[model samples]
Target: MSWSLKIFNKFPINLSSSIHARAFNSKAIGILGVPFDKGAGTRGTDKGPNALREAGLIDEIKHISSNIDVKDYGDVHYELMNTNGRKIHNLNDLSDVAACNKALADQVEKIIKDNRMPITLGGCHSIAIGSISGVLRTTTPDNLCILWVDAHLDLNTNTTSPTGNMHGMPASLLVKELRSNWPTIPELEWCKADLSLRNFCWIGLRSIDYYERIMMEQYGIKYFDMRDIDRMGIDKVTNAALKAINPNGDRQLHVSFDIDSLDPLFANSTGTPAGAGLTLRECLFLMEEVHRSGTLSSMDLVEVNPLVGDVRDVTNTLNSAKAIVCAAIGSNRSGNSS
Candidate 1:
């Protein structure tokens, strides 16, 4: 089926102004920055949103398409809670994370309702809980497919997580099927969604936890790890992932990319850097393929820590992130913008 037909059939309310129309008639991009990092174990990732902005992400994106309209919805901020003497189980900073994501969910839903493609800059991978939730509010969960690109599977629930970092458990919390198996966490009650395991596909996995591995196997989640990429090549892996996630070519695509998905040699600033990951070229190719497929609706770039490395290291990683975003938006090094 053609891309226009696929998009029109899914969102008929704006038949004349749907995503297909925007691709040709108008192009607008919404940018929302999530600056909360309580979900993470580290402190510096909170500054990631602005760091990417300072790296000229907006300007680069503008260069992608001449007619593209970009709107910046400023960062979502929260007051830090003092949990010095309190005992938190399974999840850390539960209340703060919930509050921040609630606000994020509202903003993202608004952006999508406005008929704009949302590009969320993240403080941590956990922000995905809100971003995905927000997208679900605006669109049917069964009609969306998530392309999760990360070095580690962020599928640990409170029961499976060795460390109580909420950033590592967004996938587990977002999947509706796992709710029955999840421990009762009242703070996350509002974060629930009907996200099917079949709608998710993982790439760049190299450091999955033991329990996460078990869950992936038991559920038969579609995944293409670094080893698979090495054996089958990036193009084949990308094709296989898109086919599995969007079998009918009508699902909206949401890409939640963790910067750590890149090899440590390219992205060392993230809290968890895994080796034997996708190279910068491979990552760009994957994003470009997704863009060309025309199913992309939203994207999240997370886990970039400017404070973790020297100036050069940070610069390299930041530039890499910008290039990846540009590629996802259909920019080409050969001077073609879409």
Candidate 2:
């Protein structure tokens, strides 16, 4: 009945490092890399996980809380298959994406069952489909709330998607309210529509499509864009978001952060870059608040395409991603320990 026993056979855990033994550990953090990019129209994001690891994500996080046990689950690889008979438009590599997400879901579920926090490194925003579903396997849907930090709404269904990129439709597939609108895709049948509109909130959004905007308004999903962040500040936005989604403070928090959520000035190595977005300070503050709340159970930091940018741009993007991850896990950049 243990989580490990149930799902480990499906997705084996491959620990890439043992640094936790040397650190002062307080909690266990499970790192799972989904090295998939077929979900997006771009190709470089598949390298994001290794790029982040090479940038010293584990070391930096360990420096913050050496007592925290960090276990790297290596990377999940998917074999590409011909989609000659598929019917979904703009959605490429449907089979491979589904397979990768299914494995990711199993790995994430097992990590939660092992009593560890899951930190997923994305191949694309579509990875949220598996990561969030994995978390749902371990807990009830109502007890979970998702904090989606991105520039795009990512609420497009198969029929409404302008770009058949699976990354743009994760929010739609994950929410039960939009299930009826989704086109029948057999590859994605394994995905359970466990998230509810009430359990979701958006922060740092800027480039929303017209249909997505309509859907958000129709569903009354709470969202704060760059303008709202400027109007109310990141702290106020974070407070309002947490209050709206996890009102009682007892629900589990799953943060799905797209690197594009940060302004292109801060993180420009992503596939989709927006002009004005969350500032580095705002991002860190938001993650710090989430860490302090003790409700953060899982998170996905996705869409850092190192191959697209020059060395300096890559460095800025990677460092920004690292800082955001560390902040979520309780890192204090001010050198003042709480």
Candidate 3:
């Protein structure tokens, strides 16, 4: 059973009108496929990017934003070593992850330096490190902001992670990791310390570990947990997130969206499905609000594990992809000036 990309091609958007000028620049959006799943506690997320691609994400995004110039950069290269014919906790694999991410960071740095937005599709949630870090390298220190959308805090360090899963450590790597092994590559110089803690914000957190919580609080990183979401509502939550990234709405913003943030009922196929999470409609509303924020400089969709999924898994994944496209490309016409 091969995947199909035709499902998304039928809705080509028309950019002949002036309503969506910013989204039409053919040189604006770049797509990359990072197919590594070493970060998750479970396996099989490596097939996520190709699965989404075959699901017709490219043409669907284009149709939604007719003038968008989206290009596919293909998948990052990797070699996995199996222990006794089964994959297990091997910190040695971090080197391969670093190499692939360093390359990805270089690509993203170039895209940002060229003034284009990058939309990265992931193999697992851990890939956000390379993708986001790559873009930060090209930007000024004060101009960087990262909005992490996920159900987990993802702030575990190598020492604190319960499962030794790298996905749990990307947030910690961003802030606390010493970078002794993952030194600055030529393609990703700006990524070193430029992506400071001041540029970070967390939304939709519910499954936080004690250590992760302590790390976040110690660093004073702003986070809106699910309780906050219920109180402030999705619209306000998104506004607060955008505001955190670019308070005055001047600098560029990057959104790292983890699929597991949605309720298991909505996104059951993700590697780590957190129970009490955002509803599908709430996720769409948040995306739409972000679309209107104007500072959506870069985006990433991560952690869609398809191997353990049921029949409805791909369908639900497709819906989430559509929400992302709509948020990135769809414009608010309610108050536009003619």
- lDDT (C-alpha, whole model) for all candidates: 0.82, 0.83, 0.69
Deviation from native of the Cα of residue 146 in model 2, angstroms: 0.2
Q: How close to the true structure is residue 263 of candidate 2, measured as C-alpha lDDT?
A: 90
- Flag clash pairs in model 3: 4-54, 12-63, 13-63, 24-67, 26-69, 137-190, 137-191
Per-model TM values vs. the true structure: 0.89, 0.90, 0.81
lDDT string, candidate 2, 1-338, tens digits: 32212322232222232111111112789998988888898899989999999999998877786577898888876654455677676676678778889889989998888788999998899999999999899889998899999999899987788888889989999989999987787878879896788788889888988899888768767777787778667876777777777666778889999999999889999998999888999999999888877788899999999887799999999999999999999888778353
Q: Which stretches of candidate 3 lie over 4 Å from their true place?
A: 1-27, 78-92, 176-191, 331-338
lDDT of 1 by residue, 66-182 (tens): 777888989886553444554446888788887788888889999988888888998899999999999999778898999999998899887788888999998888888788877
- TM-score of candidate 1 versus the correct structure, residues matched by position: 0.89
**Candidate with maximal lDDT:** 2
lDDT of 3 by residue, 1-338 (tens): 10111211222322232112133222367888888887677887888888888888887766654566677877877443232333324342565566667777887877776666788888778788788788767666577678888998777766667887778877666663334423343322334544567677778888988887675655566777888778767766666566655666676677889988888888888888888899887877777766665667788888887786787976786567656655565533342221
Better of 1 and 2 by lDDT: 2
Candidate 3 lDDT trough over 10 residues, lowest sum: 1-10
* Superposed Cα deviation of residue 36, candidate 3 (Å): 1.0
